[model samples]
Target: MAQQQETKSEPFDEFIVDTEDCEAREQAYRARGTARPITVVGNPVLHKECRDVTEFDDELARLVDDMFASQRAAEGVGLAANQIGVDLKVFVYDCLDDEGVRHVGVVCNPVLDELPAERRMLDDSNEGCLSVPGAYASLARPDYAVVRGQDAEGKPIAVQGTGYFARCLQHETDHLYGYLYIDRLSKRERKEALKQMAEGAPRYETVAND
Candidate 1:
């Protein structure tokens, strides 16, 4: 999950997660048990493109459930499969938009659509990743997006959002292509973000959330 800017100190606050929902999810995960450990920036799994998900079976269903649990446990609004070291084109999100509408679901092998350039709104919000824990940098992303994919059951799924949810969709989709939120940073910002990670982004064991 990428960090979002939720303060008025930044023009990108619209991209941040809802504080109340974040706490609620964390509590729910705590009650459920443990969360999966998040893969850090240095991990090879985070750098390579993920394989498409083909087997839509009980196994895929279980994986999606675990992903949702893991994301909630980490107090993140969205998470990609690779964030937990799974090299599959899948992601789970439980996020809110500026309107406070909750959007939750799983996306496998997603195809993203960005709004036309003239209609696109760029948000330079502060974004952080679970893989690069504790480090955050300003990133510009479109304010509206649509993603078409399938559910764990292979059913077609299409999600579209504005504001923060839009950012969440794009961020998670990028993970499938082996790109991190940091990769969207400007050259200078990317350098700084790397430095921050080098200084030590917190590392966690790939265990279930507690």
Candidate 2:
């Protein structure tokens, strides 16, 4: 099991959703009927670099809807298209920062702006992923980030944050580039994460096969 640790500035909230709104949206989605099965760590889709989303058509719109539905159903704060077996450069987030302010958006073909070297800060926080369910690891990531991308319709979209939200941005963007949180871990930490997965992955077999 991953040990808990407190941050100097703010405590971490691992992929927590806004309960009332998230549940309502999930219920609505269930009523309407659509949920994409989340891909797991071993899936090739999770390892391949996602392709840039070019045509913003009705198909893209529907994909965005399904992504949101799938994310809400899984109760995750952020999700990338690759996590759902889609090889597109898109991600959605309904995450919160250290102070509890909600940040929500869809980012397609994102370009990340990491903080300058002097301003960069690292936080070794416990992080989890929907794709790699039932396992968590302490990954060190920059404390702030800015991601510029587009909406489902290709309109400009940018999101910047600090604390956990910054971690979320980095994590999702990494997914677009064929990376996972475990890939950021040190060798020993990666070994522990893999062991945890070997033990707990069976619980998610049904979801993965879906």
Candidate 3:
């Protein structure tokens, strides 16, 4: 997804990395990943909360790899499991913060961290998603976000971000809990975003809802 702000990673190890290793780590995952069709907004899987990742095994690792592949293929900054029709609580992201520093990593069973007033500063910007392709709407989200979750191997990890990267963290986490960025928009804006998607199709293949 484009930032209207700005812009995954190691095996089950590196939870989050800065600009220096972001590209290389992301590439490593993408190289082994196979891009799958992104599921659209109306798909049933996209509408419901995803199941927690109970078993952190090779299968889960492979799913993370595939999510990275799909994110890159669709040119999105972040992607969640349900976006690809998987009902597991996981997502991959490669996004840049306000300072232009790129970050990449994976979060499984992500839970958002509550912020005190100081860190609750809001960032309002146009946001897009791979699922609701070709659509964007202005949304306000906490500029600084912290998400706690396990990695591919069930290792505890917490990721923190600011600016667009922060939005990516919150946005993807919401997907796991069955909420799209559009869902947070006002009724009119939500309608307009859907209209935008109808007017233009995404470049990548998407699952057609029944």
Q: Could you say which candidate leads in TM-score?
A: 3
Q: Who is ahead in lDDT, 2 or 3?
A: 3
Of the pair 1 and 2, which is ahead by lDDT?
2
Compute the lDDT for candidate 3: 0.87
**Cα lDDT computed for each candidate against the true fold:** 0.76, 0.77, 0.87
Predictions: Cα RMSD each: 8.5, 8.1, 6.7
| TM-score of every candidate | 0.79, 0.81, 0.91
Off by over 4 Å in 2: 1-33, 201-210
Query: Which stretches of model 1 miss by more than 4 angstroms?
Result: 1-34, 200-210
Q: Tens-digit lDDT track for model 3 on 119-192? A: 77888898998889899888999998878788888988878888999999999999999999999999999999
In lDDT terms, which candidate is top?
3
If the candidates were sorted by their lDDT against the true structure, best first, what order would they fall in? 3, 2, 1
Where does candidate 3 stray beyond 4 Å? 1-20
